[model samples]
Target: MNTTPAFSRRSWLQRTASGFGALALHDLVQAAQTPLAVKAPRFPAKAKRVIFLFMSGGPSQPDLFDPKDYIKRMHGKTISAPINTNELRVGTDKFLALATHGEVKPRGQSGMMISDLLPHTATIADEISLLRAVHSDNNQHQPAALQFHTGVTADVRPSMGSWISYGLGAENSNLPNFITIHPDSDTRLYGASFLPAAHQGTKVVIPQGDKQSPIDYLADVSGDAKAQRARIDFTQRMNRRLLKGAEVDARMEGMIESMEIAFRMQSATPELVDISNESEATKKLYGIGEKTTDKNGRACLLARRLSEAGVRFVQVTMGGWDHHGNIRDALPKSCSETDQPCAALIKDLKSRGLLDDTLVVWSGEFGRTPWSQDLSGTSPIHKHGREHQPESFCTWMAGGGIKPGFTFGETDDFGFRPVSGKVHLHDLHATILHQLGLDHEKLTWRHLGRDFRLTDVYGNVVKEILA
Candidate 1:
């Protein structure tokens, strides 16, 4: 008798396929569980955290940091446009030299040039390393900001914070590794394109009113902790089942991980955000209750708190620097809104002994032109504003591995191009990664059959600015 027992189709398939499925499932579960867990750096790190104070809409470099006597003397006069012959010129076709809005005097022992508009920042000039010739490729706001955050000016890519989060992971398991406070409307600025979604920046807002929550949809409406847990468990099981069948779905895997994080954050985040317990003196230092500095002050204070609590990358976006017209009247308002809060953050970090390992960077996407642009063509020289200039800008870095009480880079007499120590956006990205113990060349993610990096195959670490 051919005594082989009749094998059912279901049993045969299960027996043959179950082992492979189990192995895949096990790997997926492990990854989902520890996606944000802290990872060892490739080398010794100088900075444990990064606080990027992004001045959106490009601040004016000439009016703020790199003032030129030539430009001031030739104010309102049509000077020879040093712009590239190939480049397009619009409102700035006249190339009329624009004077600084106020005096740009030497500050601190380093003689870093700072505007009278930023009095608070001037006081801490000794603590900063000023880069006078930071340049980017784009002149437009959206594209320039994109380049600043994602390395590329056009295509969507992982943001700098996302990359850092991927490289270092979360120091505090209860919080996200990357947090962007009051970010721009563009989600691409914080998105973790192609990389694991868990590495993306978590958007946070400083509550304006007593009733508002810093993060929306954070409250549990079910009001039953046990019941919520049960629902989450059920959802996770289904997600895992789907993942196991698919073998690999990065999006689904990220969803699984993010859901768990959201659940946990409900319990851990509220206390961290609450500022009622903060001392009055500390609040005053940040200008928290004051009218002019209230919004950014709260945001900056929150950034410090988040960083101190082990968040790897924290960003505070302060907008309204886009002074296309009437810059003389507009620039000081912008400076007043941001100066004190930003300076206070530096001081607070130093007081807490966090400054040594905390990298604080202040910059815009690009700087404004030294030439005036009068849209009406009838406006006076004082009323005419500057145009965008991508050739050169000013950026300042404090703490981390930077040389304090020093200035690096230089601009030509026109303040239109870098004469020396030119640091491109790529170089800036590379240097930031280097300070965090990440090799820019080695810290890459494979996407679309090739490796991609923050510097995008072009960047040299600016070693001269390093301490």
Candidate 2:
């Protein structure tokens, strides 16, 4: 029995009440609390929120960030190098070719050695810092990503974005403080679980197409504006009545805030998502035109727009990095999609002087392993394949309070594990929160009779990377 029916544009718009023109998108999803309302930082705050770029499908570290001297130590190892060198699958072979292509050289004044695949990012090396020793607990997909986004890698905690929204009220009264834009075939990437429904990212502008106007209802579902007010009032009354005896319902408060902001967005979102208002030059710089019109570029452009409009957090999620095989062939396309716009976004932010206050993070759930999955190959490099590695990887930081042009931490010669300045996922989260003026350890909710925080009991601010 096929109960699912075909979806049309009109039906889609009506079903997804969120407007198309990028209206008060954050309000679309209700949150349990506001992160902006968290206590002021003990010291100076560097950033307000975060723009997290999640590269799902785990990118390989050796091929991308850390080409090591240790690969030679294990020469003759054979594995499937998924891409350019795909035919090189073998067993019991040593040393996979350190990197598929060119070397990762020191760039900018900081001399951070980013792989050649990320040439655009190299230009701004002096403005960014790289964390080379990020190790996670898992090798699987959903679990790792979930743990990365939510503090409980075990699948039982609130997400960092959700916690931030909970701690702080929205900075923009008319918009949701936290927003996420992920272009994928699935919805779970941005779905809200225990967090208040309102706190979840409002998919203001889905990645359908230009005419889709992701925010269709944004203009007004009704001909009469005042009539809209009546609907909001009616909904609020129902919520208030439903929880009449509740001691403290953060979820309900989040709902109230969302509704209020939605009413206000009727006047704001259309303008914010309108690239027409931006200079043609700016669009060109973002690679919105011609040959560079890739999905990742569009996301980067949207991220810049959202941040400029005062969005507290604008997460641009680009999945499909899982290069278990064919890495050499896939990396070029993957790099093509991201390399340019990411760098452009930074340059644009700096030009607008927003970089100092806006923080950008590029990372994945975990890195791919140095050894091939089968552990038996003939050549130093596999046939463009790499296995899962929870031991070590890299992530980058720019703007906010991060020290630019620096590479923090180190991995063993084979890039198998972190040997210096190891920072775990929780520590990273804590540091991000610290920059936004909240103590990750202190910003907690009493759930199940215990105080649960974004960092839990572990996590220390990596002060060395601070500006």
Candidate 3:
């Protein structure tokens, strides 16, 4: 009865449904074509870009930024056990108070307490806002780092850089919105889960040799730009034909966009990664030629360069701060490798007048305990190191809308817990988003029928630290 003389009802409905699908596919194709195109912020922004200096292993706060008088007085003696009894620890059962390996004296006009191990950082103490009681939930490396980047410790979620990339897009169309230099092996630290894959951070390495490309497989093996373009055009046509037949394919669209970016990057990235054009003065400022600081110095310098070139977010990770034995001998080495490069980044940005619109953050996942921890259980007091402490740590922010020369938060006498002005990692994430003109609560993406955000239903901006 349905096929009385012509087309069946089922065939007609199928044809009409395909036309509707094509209409939806058109919108997705247009969006993928310019995914990184710059978008306006929700409001006026104090910072246009962000540079995150990630200290991978937990850096000791008592040894680097905070020193407690009570802990010093009770050095080598048993103090009240402030840690939870349920938690298992390798050493530090005796609760022997560990004094700071070096002195932390007041520096700059701000009277910010800094260690002698970071002389370069001390020089810029007046330009930074030191947060002495920053806390997080996890103690393990991977999960704590996940919390630091994704706000939740247990699940895979969009990272802060990826969220920022989604929010503001990119100021430079030729480059990615998010780039991480020398990141950890874990991809989750910079992943863009549940978001467009285009927002995922592009990993880069500072080339050790003259001919090595900073990005893997960057060199065009075809040897002809015209031939490459022709091949890409053909491939894109095939991809679009495949996309037209699908209901929805965000990953397919992302791959299309990524391939285009990779083609464009073949021309744009080489000049940015080459540091030879930089002046001798600039090179020396970052300690580029020195053997002790060469690796990190190159990474930091590259970060500044990329930031200046309009990359929305850049991260540089420096590790080796996990000290469980012979801390006095080890902590200084870690400091030496990173101190100058980090401080130089601030100064270089300031000199270029970029600091006013750039937010620079320096922090680790957590901090070390004030009590001695000897994993070997046979080391002396001076040789013993500290255990992981997620209760309190130090994080510093510079430029953007942050108040320079200001110090916020305080910890208990034992340096085990926050006593005042506690700023959780969630709060830090909120404040950073706020400075960039994104309300942490409002910048969200819908997934699985619920709105997800970087702060995840928590976080309050610490107004006192704002300029």
Per-model TM values vs. the true structure? 0.92, 0.83, 0.93
Provide the global lDDT of candidate 1 against the true structure: 0.87
Question: Would you list the C-alpha lDDT of every candidate in the order shown?
Answer: 0.87, 0.69, 0.87
Q: Global CA lDDT of candidate 3, please?
A: 0.87
lDDT of 2 by residue, 217-259 (tens): 5667686878988988899888877645452354665567667
Q: Write the per-residue lDDT of candidate 1 for residues 168-222, one digit (tens) a residue.
A: 7788878888999999999999999887788898989888787787887888999
lDDT of 3 at 58: 90
| Residues 269-299, model 3: lDDT tens digits | 9999999999999889999999999899999
Error of 3 at 292 (Å): 0.9
- For each candidate, how many residue pairs have backbone atoms clashing (under 3 Å)? 0, 71, 0
Q: Clashing pairs in model 1?
A: none
Error of 2 at 372 (Å): 3.3
Give the true-structure RMSD of model 2: 9.5
Q: Residue 24 deviation, candidate 1, in Å?
A: 21
Q: Please report how far candidate 2 places residue 413 from its true position, in Å.
A: 1.1
lDDT of 2 at 37: 40
